[model samples]
Target: MLVLGIDTSCDDTSVSVYDAKENRVLSNIVSSQYSFHREFGGVVPEIAARKHAENIDLVFEEALEVAGVGVKDLNLISVTNRPGLLPALLVGLTFGKGLAYSLSVPFKAVHHIEAHIFSPFIGSEPEYPFIALVVSGGHTLIVLVEGFGSYSLLGKTLDDAVGEAYDKVAKLLGLGYPGGPVIDRLYREYDGKYLELPKPKVKGFNYSFSGIKTAVRRLVEKGYPAEQVAASFQETAVSYLIGKLKKALKETGVRRVAVSGGVSANSLLRERLKELDVDLYLPPLEYTSDNGAMVAYVGYRRFLIEGEDTLEVGALARCPIS
Candidate 1:
């Protein structure tokens, strides 16, 4: 069955078509509003919401065009409905509802984080009973996935997310807008061993980046080399992430591991995680962020795993897939 997914969880407006039986993405399109929010140093809710209201149609149209199918051809309609910026979410929900009603198809509301956990299956087959680390701009979470839509939270941030840490450090160093990639590139120029950044010694499957964020600032002001400081900052941040991730794996006893969200797009993170010698999955470069394709794919799997949901499914600004 064909499921159409719509996503406007934050700065990107995206649409995707997925085939439940085949477990594949027929077409996925994303319209990014990064440039509009770049100068502001972060996303502005009002501007992002307004842009999503305008771009949803164009993004959906492109999805159909790329998939070689129209709205009428879809068997189910789905949109992200929770755990996102409220203003950004309403646009996708409103558009998705209208399309579902007009086409008389079942409408499903999927959680944003759930969609991220399921994103790896966008192009490949899925593996069950694994650990999924969801690291993005606003969230950092570890989930022990037992099956489709069946997961238990293993760990999460006590304060700022990993992505936010990267961004903050980047801004301090005069780097570009999404901080992780730039910090990573600049890290190659410095020695990570130089700075003695604090590592949040949180015990057992929990994470804390608040101290690291503060420590980086103090180190920079104390005459640390710019390049080495950048390198140490990234290393410490990733070290904390990897530390908790490994802890989650041990606690859950699941070697099959995967990660998703905008920060997962980082080259260094991917490289580090790949060395684990476990069955691992990462989204295609396009699926690493908030894209409609992941939503559609999640919707497709949901319908099959839990059966078809009524079009009366409620819209939520916060929801739990489990």
Candidate 2:
């Protein structure tokens, strides 16, 4: 089946078409609005949603053109439905719903975070029963995915997500918007010992980054070098993530693990997770961050597994397979 995926979860206006039969990304296009939102320090929901509305059609057309497919060729329609700016979510959903209805295709409402966890399996299908560490601007969650449509929420963050930490620290260092990558670059130049940052003591699979944020803020207040503080912040963030992944691996007993989200593109996290010696799965640089390809892949796969039947689907801000 050919599936079309739409993702307007945040600042990026993304669309992709997947060919499940061939098992590959026929087309994946992401139009980032970072430049528009940069002045705001981060994504402004209203601004982001409005931008999506303006560009959604163009991005949608581009995806189809790149895929070399027409709407009539698609058998399924998928859109991220959740845990995002409601208006942004609606932008994609409304368009997707209309497209599905017009084409007489099946509509699959996907959870934004779940689509992130499902990212690694795009193109080449990975084995099931793996651990998923989803770190993004708004969320951080470690989940146990038994299979498509089946998952358990093992743990999450109490305050800021890893991406949020990156953005905040980037702002402190005068780095522009979408700070994760920029700060990661700075981390290589400076040592993070301007002040010993503390990792939050989270219980079980749960996590907390608020304390570290406060620590960084205080360091900035004390007049530490911006680069050093940025470096230190990056170090602690990567260390904490790996530490948590190890904990989840040991506790969940899932030797296969996957990491997703905009922050997953961080080289440090990628390198650190490699040391675990597990069947580690990560999205290619292209797939990392918010995009529609993962959603299309997820929907297409589920449709294949279920033989074209229907199930309950909705735009859920908090839909956990668990």
Which stretches in model 1 have alpha-carbon errors above 4 Å? 189-193, 223-225, 307-315, 320-322
Q: Each model's TM-score? A: 0.93, 0.94
Q: Residue by residue across 125-209, what tens digits does model 2's lDDT show?
A: 7788999999889888998888777888889998888899889888877788989988888877774354579988879888888
Give every collision pair in model 1: none
What digit string (tens of lDDT, one per residue) describes model 1 on residues 77-161? 8898887788998899889988888988888888899889878777676778988898988888888898886788877888888
Give the poorly placed runs of model 2, Cα more than 4 Å off. Answer: 191-194, 305-314
Tally clashing residue pairs in candidate 2: 2
Deviation of model 1 at 240, angstroms: 1.5
